[model samples]
Target: MNPLYQIFVDPFVQMAGAPDLFAQTIWEGFVGGMLYALIALGYVLIFKASGVFNFAQGIMMVFAALTLVGLHEMGVHAYIALLLTLGVMYLLAVGVERAVLRPLVNQPDIILFMATFGLTYLLIGAGELVFGGNPKTMIAKELGLPSGGIDFNILGGLVSLQRIDIAAAVIASILVAGLAAFFQYTRVGRALRAVADDHQAALSVGISLNEIWVVVWFAAGVVALATGVMWGARSNVSFALQIVALKALPVLILGGFTSVPGAIVGGLVVGIGEKLGEFYWGPLLGGGIESWLAYVIALAFLLFRPHGLFGEKIIERI
Candidate 1:
């Protein structure tokens, strides 16, 4: 086959030939994309409320998962461990607000960004010390997450759907909706939006910056815990999972750093595009395309839509 024809025509022809396979691939991509969106949502929550990029969010997810698994290992019930984990995350949010954010209230954005970097390393060290540097099981069975999958026969092929993935997608969707409602209808949410727009202005209006920081950080922590649970169930709970969580960066770039809906759409696009690219174009270029394909797509989006698909444009007058 000619290179041009193979590159342009072959993949679609293969998709048409194996419709079931195509559907299966899409399903898998959707599941993966939902997880990515969950992680990206953590970033969005903090950035929107605090104007900080939150370099520690990925590690926060890993730490939250490790904390849950560690607590379960200590003979706590799975559900109990989950609640305790949320409490721990809340305490962490408070600690971060007091120790890290409060003192630096009027600092430059770069300083806040660097503070999160220190927080990341601090969490990594503390997690390793407390939980030990070992991979642990996610306790999915104890948590009541599904274990088996359903299979469908179509176009002379089989398409399998995991119950856990479906559950994860549903749970993520509900969480996102709940968060949207919270941000739109709650008093704290309005205060957060005001702070996001201008910290000094929010303070001038009698909103307590310390209280808002703690609230947003705690909100981000809740998001991290959910992402950790779902992703941990899919794979072993380990520090290495933080690397996978970093893929949210590209999702943020594609969707926009501060847009909640953008995270969902960006994640789906990255997820589906990468899976399709690897399945169809990997052999043509060589395998291992899945790893870098997302960054490439993000780079393209950066070139075309720098503010992202859902991001607001910033205009300044000199």
Candidate 2:
């Protein structure tokens, strides 16, 4: 057997020999991609409204999860803790709008982007100070999320699917649908789109920038909380989960900065591509390829479609 054949042909042969494993791998990839899409959705919400590329979205997720767990640890009920967390996120939105966006209005986009970096650090410090630097188990049982998975026998092998993963997928789908509806039909959503298109024009029509900023940030925060809960249920809640933000970057790039549908499609591509690359071709390159394979997929797509799969094409006249 030649090295090329071993690298390319062997994995397919293995998959043919065991179809169950391939199905399992694909299921895992889809779940991972769905989680990544949740994070990307948060980014889309913030970017659509304020034009700020929120660097803190991942930290916000970690912070939201830590707050929920920490509150539970301090004798609060799970449902109560959840509500309190929502209140905290709302306050956070208010504070950010008053202290950050208000003062920085009319600044360059780069400055706003930098401000989110500062916000990231602030969230990290606050989360650590309040929750300590320890991993905490998510209160999945308390939250009524499914505990274990079901196994299926196929092609003389077994494929296991976690119920939580299914729930995550369903929930993500609902969130996406709900957001699309809100953006398409609601008055506030119309106002948000208007602001996204032209800030000065929106203001001239009596739209309050501060009010819109607070609303948009709060919406992003709600998304962060939902993402944190779903992700924490799959794994332990910790500051380290912030790394998902990096994985989601390729999804954002592949989808387009301002597109919700693009995020979902991009996430699925990155997720499935990363897993398949790691499973089939990773051994040829000595493994651990999943970490960077997504970027390769994003870069490949970008070479052909620079603005992303669903990004709005721009035209300029010089």
Candidate 3:
């Protein structure tokens, strides 16, 4: 077998020989991509309203998941723990607006960006202080998530689909749709759009910047919680999970920071690309290429598009 042929053609031949495996791989990638989209959506919400590229979103997801799981461990009911976690996130939004954004209003974008990094460190310290820096199991059974998976026979092979992954996909779809509806039709949504367009102009038109900031942060928090739950169900919730947020960097680059639809599409592209590349071509490179493949894909797209696939093109007037 030619080395190049083994690297390039063998994977496809294997895929062609086992259609079921290909389908399974695709499904796995799709689920992974949806999770990436969820995280990217959090970034979009914050960026749109405040022009702050929040670096703390990954921490927020872990923190939220930890809070819920911690509460349940302390003997609180699952649903009650969930409600309490939401309350915590809401309060956190209010606190951030008052303590961070309000004081830093009108500052340079770099300053605001730095503030989120500070916030990230603060959350990390606080979460560790409270939660003891331990990995906790997600209360999937308590939360009523489906366990086990369904198996299907295709192309003379068994393709097993995890019920939880299916649920994650469905929940992600619903959340994205819900957010779309909220942004398109609600008065607050219109104000949010205005704020995203121009903060000073939004204030001139009677939109309260403070209120908008709080709402945006709160919305991002809610997104973080949902992401946390889904992710925790898939694996143990730990500080290490915060690394997943880094995956969103390529996603944002691929989708553009401001477009929600771009997040979804970019995530799927990155997810599927990484999986296929890892499964097929990974061994040639001695494996473990999944970590960086998505970035390569994003960089490839960046060379051509610059702003991203769905990102708005900027026209500079001299």
Per-residue CA lDDT of model 3 for 1-318, tens digit only, reads: 799899768999999998988998898999999999999999999998899999999999999999999999999999999999999999999999999999998899899999999999999999999989989999999998998999998778999999999999999999999999999999999999999998889999899999989899988998999999999999989999999889988999999988999999998998888888988789889999999999999999999999999998988999
- Model 3 earns a TM-score of 0.98
lDDT of 1 by residue, 97-209 (tens): 99999898778999999999999999999999999999998999999998899998877899999999999999999999999898889999899899888878998999998
TM-score of model 2 (CA atoms): 0.96
* Shift of residue 12 alpha carbon in model 2, Å: 2.3
**How many clashing pairs in candidate 3?**
0
Task: lDDT winner between 1 and 3, please give it.
Answer: 3
Candidate 3 regions exceeding 4 Å error are: none
List the candidates' TM-scores in order: 0.97, 0.96, 0.98
Who wins the lDDT comparison? 3
**Candidate 1, after superposition: displacement of residue 164 in Å?**
0.5
Error of 3 at 14 (Å): 1.5
Looking at model 1, the pairs that clash are none
Instruction: Give the higher-lDDT candidate: 2 or 3.
Output: 3
For all candidates in order, the CA lDDT equals: 0.92, 0.91, 0.93
| Residues 32-55 of candidate 2: C-alpha lDDT, one tens digit per residue | 999898899899888878899998
lDDT of 1 at 151: 92
